[model samples]
Target: MKIARYEHNGFPHVGIVNHGKVNSLPDGTDVLETLNLPLDAQYRLQASAGRHHRVPLEDVRFLPPIEPRAMRDFVAFEAHITGMKKAEPGDGSVPEAWYEAPAFLFMNPWSLTAPGADIPMPPLTKALDYEVEVAAIVGTAARDVTPEQAREHIVGYAIFNDWSARDIQGREMQVGLGPSKGKDFANTLGPWITTPDELEKFRLADGRLDLEMSVTINGVQTGSDRLSNLSWTFEELVSHASRDAWVGAGDVLATGTCASGSLAELWGRAGRQDPPPLTVGDVISITVQGLGTLTNRISPQTSTGVPVPPAWSRRQPKESP
Candidate 1:
């Protein structure tokens, strides 16, 4: 089943795509809450799926499936690491004790947008970039999970775009503070969470995820790669992530970007000069097999701070409360 979080009539909703229509699920606090039915359980529910209302996919806006109690992104893809190593000096894709500990980013849980939305191009960056990744959504609650037992926690997978700012990231890393601001601006997700049972049909074909992956700027295809290129498996990510932390329903673990990032290695493969970074009106679309395409348009930034309307500025309380 293709599960999605969308907005209709200004209200956010959880839904499943049936045929080509989106069928609303029962109202719940988060994606997992509304659609936590497991594959077998969900199949049973379909016989009596309650409160469902179909809506056109275009009329509603999408949102990241989970309103996670906590969220982190992992670098589980080797191609991304190799690419970063060459793009910047001293950058090693083989993380220290990575196999043992796993590398992850503690990102802002609130900084996510849904599919078919407009992302504010950060004012601080002219070097805006994109990272195409595949991620897993955790289903059940568990702590200190073992690698062998990790698959039990996984619910499904989705495509992720870790939008980035190279310059801010470069400056922030100097402080060893993690990829805070550079990463917090926006992370695009959705197009639906495809479950494990549904995923089994895809086989690894020729060392690549049988799924076709590609990116388009506006309407032009720019980069492409396969899911088979992932360095680490989702099971490993789940085990490592749950080492000390509790992974609950709706938690998402992202497979880091693959070889085709907007910040591509011009000197390495193509030998073409690196293109200038993205600008306003640039639309980035990432398509993965099974999972559908996620498209977002770049819009100019307003202010560097959290978005606030002029009417909401807390003025001096009319010279005294």
Candidate 2:
């Protein structure tokens, strides 16, 4: 089942996607509320379907499937990690600790945007890029869950674009801390969420998804890979994320970039300059099998009042002779 949140006639509505059309529920109903319900209750609600007002899919404006209460993005692809390490001036070996467990970083939930929304090019960055990924939405509160129990807590999945500013991110990593401003500007989620029941058929015996994920820039295919390539399964990622912490309904957890899913990785492997970083008017589309495509265009940067300094102004501090 595909669940969606959309705007029609200046009001937001939650609905189910069927036959290329949207069957919107009564006004003021929140989609997150449904996600918070128990799995059996949710199934019952689906079984007792109501006659909702239907609308043509093209008419409604898409919103992020839900306003996430919190977000965590994990780096779970070995090839992607190797590529990233090689792109920087460092030993390109995957960290040994990564094999032991999944590593993740908290992302700003407020940065969420909808499908078809124009993502503003962050003025502070000259190396803007996109990370094609899949996000699992939490269905219920979980604490200290095991990998075997994680899937039960996941309500659905959605396509995620973890927009990045490489230059800023590199500088911060040099200080031994994870990203901050570079990733906080924009992170998109939508088209809609595909329920777990709809994806069960594609799950492998080991629990990894067999979904195909791809990325396109302005209609040109740049990269493609299978979700099965992930070093850690979504269940493991969720389990690791919930270790000693409570993950509540509406929290979003994204699998990091797939192999060759971002420009940095592509350029690092080919030993060539990155295709021009995203600029105003460039459309980026990311699609995952079972989950739908999410498309966003780059928009002109808005003035933040603080000007980016010239290169000379970034010189190291002078020492006493």
Candidate 3:
């Protein structure tokens, strides 16, 4: 089942998409209330529930499908890792343990915007970049989950754009923080969350997760890759995150970006040229196979200049009276 949140007449809401119309629901934003509902259940509820209504597809705005109880974005794509290594060889690919260890970095929830919304260019940031990623939403709680049981916990998948500030990220990593500053600002997620049952109907030609994807900037394709190339599986990531942590419903887990989804394309193989970064009004679109496209516009942040000190400071401490 496809679960969605949309906005109409400036008020946000939850809905189900069927035959091109968005049927609105009158419930709190509790995703579990209707997420992953089978088509039969959905139809039954629409007919029986007086709170349900439908809106024309062209009139509503889409929001991220799930309000995750917790968000954990993992770096499981090898191509992104290797590309970053080649882009900045000094950085080097993560240690082998990282493959087995399955690490994740936290992203700012305040930065989240809808699929078609305009994203703001951060103040004083010139090295703005995008990463294409896939994320899974958990449907049930699982601690110390095994790979075989991981699939049951997954509710669905969606496309994510991990907008980054490379300069701030590099500085923070040196302090062993792992993307506290560089990774904040903007994280785009939307289109819709595809339930596990829907995904089960499709598989890569090689029977893997290698889905075709691309990232375009200003109507130009900048990078492209496949999900099949991931170094680790989604199960491994789930297992890793589940250890000592309570995996609960609405938890979002991001599978890292693939090879071509790095900033090196705009930068260089070694060191990039001076200040190859995003300016206001740049549009970025991240597309994943089956999942719809997530498009966002980058605009300059509104600034009010630096503030001046109070008159008391200008007058000095008055001889420490």
Stretches of candidate 3 off by over 4 Å are 26-29, 36-53, 89-94, 204-207, 265-270, 273-275, 303-321
Candidates in descending lDDT order: 2, 1, 3
TM-score of each: 0.84, 0.91, 0.84
Cα lDDT computed for each candidate against the true fold: 0.74, 0.86, 0.73
What residue pairs clash in candidate 2, if any at all? none
Pick by TM-score: which candidate is best? Answer: 2
TM-score of 3: 0.84
Question: What is the per-residue lDDT of model 3 for residues 239-271, given as tens digits with 9 covering 90 to 100?
Answer: 778988888877788887766785754354546
Model 2: weakest 10-residue lDDT segment is 305-314
Summarize candidate 2's per-residue lDDT along 1-321 as a digit string, tens digits.
678999888888888877877887666767877766666876766654335667888888998889978999999888898887777775778778888888999999999988989999897788889999999998888899999899888888999999999888878788899998788888999899888888999999988999999999999999999999988888888898999999878899999999989987887876665676788999999989998889999999885838556455437765559
Query: Which residues of candidate 1, in runs, are more than 4 Å off?
Result: 27-30, 47-52, 90-101, 203-210, 264-273, 305-321
Top lDDT model: 2
Model 3, global lDDT: 0.73
Indicate whether candidate 1 or candidate 3 has the larger lDDT.
1
Supply candidate 1's per-residue lDDT for 236. 69
